[model samples]
Target: MISPDAFHAACLGLGAGLALIVAIGAQNAFVLRQGIRGEHIGPIVAVCAISDAILIAAGVLGTGALLTAAPAAVVGLRYVGAAFLITYGVMAARRILTPKALESADPESSGSSRSGRAATLATVLALTWLNPHVYLDTVLLLGSLANTQGPGLQWWFGAGAMLGSIAWFSSLGFGARLLRGFFARPASWRILDGGIAVTMVGLGVGLALGT
Candidate 1:
């Protein structure tokens, strides 16, 4: 029979990963926007999956525990992350409200660029790195949680969590791509931008409120 502990770890890891990822936030929303626009898929997925795997591995290996011991450090990160997310959200909202005319579209930020592979990588790095909370949640919190599951099953647990990350992100990419064809209208951009803005602002507020 499969070890009960391993099974439990797998379930917990999967659940935790999915629970955290499913919520629409800056990263997911931005990915959706790009996927919808038929932008670079490989680099987007790479950014998401690689970041997740690295974080999950760190979590499982119990490397992020250092931060957990220091309450002040995590709190500091939370505030900084919230501010950045709010700024990002507001900018996205502005883009929606004042989308440039098709004839005079301005250059996109490196993250939103339509260039080749280099721009694609740049986008992923910027999006993932801008938010400090990635470390708090994925590294410290999840790592601490995994450490409690016992050493024997930590890898399995981490693997399940990784799967969850892959599933959620891939879905976000492909699903967004599918919708892109039908919802490529100008009005659709507004709707998506509005939704992203709301999600980002809400998350930022939640982070700031700490409850």
Candidate 2:
């Protein structure tokens, strides 16, 4: 029952959402790790997808332009996000130095660690919300793009963008288990941790430098 123009706008939104989201970054890495561990996958994926949906809606409502006007707010968020990324990167590096298997490191799997469901969820929330780049992407970039579709069809574009988030996070959080066999070895965990550390630190530095 959808009109051709609406369909086209939806397609554009979907493509843009995917292009912005489906990249190597801290959020994706965390989702992949959680998926592999088979711990809190549902809650984690739901949080990410829902968060994106809300942000996209905000963007489509023209909040992105409002945010763009707030240069000081953006700068503050950028520094906070950089600090968070750096801190997370340091944690990843510590995991590598500890010489424990990734599976064993997870309290959810071993039940001996201090991190509980609440703690894990907190971490997920912090990772998603603390990252200022997320706002820039979902709010400013996607919002501006959606507005360009004209007022009547912008909501369709936002809906399509939300669909993209749902599809992507679902795939990432659920589909990551397919690689469990490859990550069975401790060395794989170490390598993954190293990559994660590098990525986080690199991104943190990039944000700090504003490059």
Candidate 3:
């Protein structure tokens, strides 16, 4: 049986993890889009959850402290992420003007093909890794929080956080299929793309300006 202290730590970690990740951000937005498209949902969700697990583990291992000392590295990532977000935003905006025909979520669909899956995988990775906020939130904040649970309980806390990440990504990726009918409409896609473009560009500007 798990000890009371360990259980408490795990609960705390779970709550913190969910709180941090449930926000509507670039990463979540991309995941939602891919999920709706019904393309590479498994790989996309796996990448997100696995990436979070790795980052949370690193933080619990004290990499958060190391990152804190390397302000320059964070700044570099910020700018790079900003550029990528803005570029992607432009692409999304272009899609609004020149939308493609709504394709079914067939295995043979262009988006579900091997090359397309590869591109989607790359995009998800970039969306996860490039964002400086992820490092700050997952590595620094969550790591520090884990350490506070004391050595014996820190791992439990990290495990809880990891569980939270897995559950969330699974729910988001798999649950989005329920809305496939709504998104099947080209008008709905245009609206979604418009919103994505605005969100991406806004975030990019904020990151670039260090706001």
TM-score per candidate: 0.79, 0.93, 0.96
Residue 158 CA displacement from its true place in model 3, Å? 0.7
Candidate 2 lDDT, 57-102, residue by residue in tens: 9999889988878989988888998998899999998888786546
The all-Cα superposition gives candidate 3 an RMSD in Å to the true structure of 1.3
Report the C-alpha displacement of residue 162, candidate 3, in angstroms: 0.8
Query: Top model by TM-score, which number?
Result: 3
Give the better candidate number (1 or 2) by lDDT: 2
lDDT pick, better of 2 and 3? 3
Which residue segments of model 2 deviate by more than 4 Å?
A: 104-115
Global lDDT for candidate 2?
0.86
In angstroms, the error of model 1 at 40 is: 1.7
lDDT of 1 by residue, 75-140 (tens): 776777678678767977887768571111112322344466676567567557655567778887
Better of 1 and 2 by TM-score: 2
1 or 3, greater by lDDT: 3
Q: Point out the worst 10-residue segment of candidate 3 by lDDT.
A: 101-110
Q: Itemize residue pairs with steric clashes in candidate 1.
A: none
